[model samples]
Target: MKEKIEQALFEVRPYIEYYEELKKRVEEIASTTDEEGLFIKLLEEEIKKSEEPFKTDLRIFLQKFTSFL
Candidate 1:
């Protein structure tokens, strides 16, 4: 499970590094809550507002991550 989550994070790392809002939200989630579900939900919401390739990448990431749950 840890490995799967890590893999999901790895897939999303570039986007998080590229987007200020995403990076900030991830950091905020990390600091405020240990709930992975909330983190995934927030990411899904953010992805809905994103454009093309990035949105697709994030959706894939979410699908992979949620599969573990």
Candidate 2:
């Protein structure tokens, strides 16, 4: 399972990096009151995109990801 996880991570590295970048951008937008709605929209879109692969156990994935950070 560990090896399979590693392989999956290798394949998804680009997506991870992209998501990280988007997260950073979202943080920036979050700081501005004028674009609060846009920030939420962007966050929703990002979550929606991530939900496909993460449908099996969304809460578990979030917990692990938060711990890693």
Candidate 3:
């Protein structure tokens, strides 16, 4: 399970970087839009979507560690 998680991280690392860049770009693009509320909402949605998987992985890791203890 640990190895599987690591392998998954290796596969997802690039996407994480991609999403970071995308999040930055979204913020920059949103800054230029007149509908600031909509822009902020979309930006947050993009970030939340990208972050959920990572958060899940962290929660799984914490559970694994707690079980080991």
| Winning candidate number (TM-score) | 1
**lDDT values, one for every candidate:** 0.65, 0.42, 0.45
Off by over 4 Å in 2: 1-34, 52-69
Looking at candidate 2, the ten consecutive residues that score lowest on lDDT are 55-64
Which ten contiguous residues of candidate 3 have the minimum total lDDT? 60-69
lDDT of candidate 1 over 1-69, digit per residue (tens): 446656766766665534544445446645655688777777778787878756765676677688878
What are the RMSD figures for all models against the true structure?
4.1, 10.6, 13.0
Which lDDT tens digits does candidate 3 get at residues 1-48?
334333433444444534454434544645566564554455455545
Backbone clash tally (model 3): 0
Off by over 4 Å in 1: 1-4, 10-32
Candidate 1 lDDT (Cα, 0 to 1): 0.65
- Supply candidate 2's per-residue lDDT for 8: 38
Give lDDT tens digits, candidate 2, residues 1-69.
233333433444454534444335444544553443454454455566654444323333333333432
